[model samples]
Target: DAGVTQSPTHLIKTRGQQVTLRCSPISGHKSVSWYQQVLGQGPQFIFQYYEKEERGRGNFPDRFSARQFPNYSSELNVNALLLGDSALYLCASRATGTNEKLFFGSGTQLSVL
Candidate 1:
């Protein structure tokens, strides 16, 4: 089966503009998730949804929001973009069960001007 996939691999936006990124999980995965990687930092947890319900969220500001569809795919929305928000927005997914490994997508690169 295909791995996770994200759309519009690259995008550019100015400060104060809003952006929406989309993701599709691997087949049969019941959870959709998020993480972000800054310049030199490791992936930081952001948000997650399982069984189509939000399961967790990171310390990001209210400008960030997301939702999981009934099919387990997800959409991430950012309001009032900021240069600091420019990073590789990663999508992740996991099968439900103990010891299941999380799978990550290549990520959508968002550049804020």
Candidate 2:
């Protein structure tokens, strides 16, 4: 089964443009989460969705949003992007059980010029 998949692999946008990144979870997984990783820092949790319901959100501003589909695929959207928002947007997924290990995708590299 696949671990996780993210689309567009890379993106380039202006400071005020908006962008959307997509992800597909592994088979038998019901939980999907998003994270942002700056070049030299650990990934920061952005949002998490389980069973198509919002479960958690991080300290990111309102410009960030996400949604999970019935099939467990998800999308992360960012509005009014800023240069500071440039980073690797990662998608992670885990089985529906306690202590399940998370699996991550290669991520979408967003560059705000």
Candidate 3:
């Protein structure tokens, strides 16, 4: 069985542009969450979806959004990217909700110029 995976290990973009990052959850997992980690900072939750329905969300701006698919994959979309948006976008998945152990992918490192 494969663990969580993310695409485009690194990304570079300019301000005012948009970017989309992808994630695939572990087998048999139905919940996928998106997080952002700034340089030297801890990961902050962005959004979480379970069974294709949004289960939880964090203190993120409208520019950040995500959705889970029926196959348990997910995508994180950021609109109107800013230089401050440069960070590592991490994807985490859990077999179940509440206190479940989360598995994370290395993440897509986004750089805004």
Candidate 4:
């Protein structure tokens, strides 16, 4: 069994560009969620997808969106990035229909210049 995994451990971009982050959930998991952690702040939920549908969302702007594939992999997209968007984009997953503990990947560190 493999834990969750994310691509591009680190990323650098200038303001106003768009970026996409990827995530692959652990085996047998059906729910994937996206979170953003700014410097010195706890992770804040961005979006959650379960069974290929949006399950939950946080207080984020329309620029933030995500979707879970049938294979349980997920991608988070951010458009018109702002300096405030620079943060550790963490991807988490849990078993379906249960509040089980989430498995978090190291995350893609996005740095907006």
- Winner by lDDT: 2
TM-score of each: 0.96, 0.97, 0.95, 0.96
For residues 5-83, write the lDDT of model 3, one tens digit per residue.
9998999999999999999999988889999999999999999899999888899899998888879999999999999
Predicted candidate 4 versus true structure: per-residue lDDT over 12-92, tens digit per residue: 999999999999999998989999999999999999898999988999999998888889999999999999999999999
**How good is model 4 by TM-score?**
0.96
Least accurate 10 contiguous residues by lDDT in model 2: 94-103
Clashing residue pairs in candidate 2 are: none
Most TM-score-accurate candidate: 2
| Residue 69 miss distance in model 2 (angstroms) | 0.5
* 5-104: candidate 1 lDDT, tens digit per residue: 9987999999999999999999999898899889799889899899888899999998999999988899999999999999999999988884657899
Model with the higher TM-score, candidate 1 or 4 = 1
Backbone collisions counted per model = 0, 0, 0, 0
Q: Compared to the true structure, candidate 2 yields what TM-score?
A: 0.97
- Compared with the true structure, the alpha-carbon lDDT of candidate 4 equals 0.93
Candidate 4: RMSD to truth: 0.9
TM-score of 3: 0.95
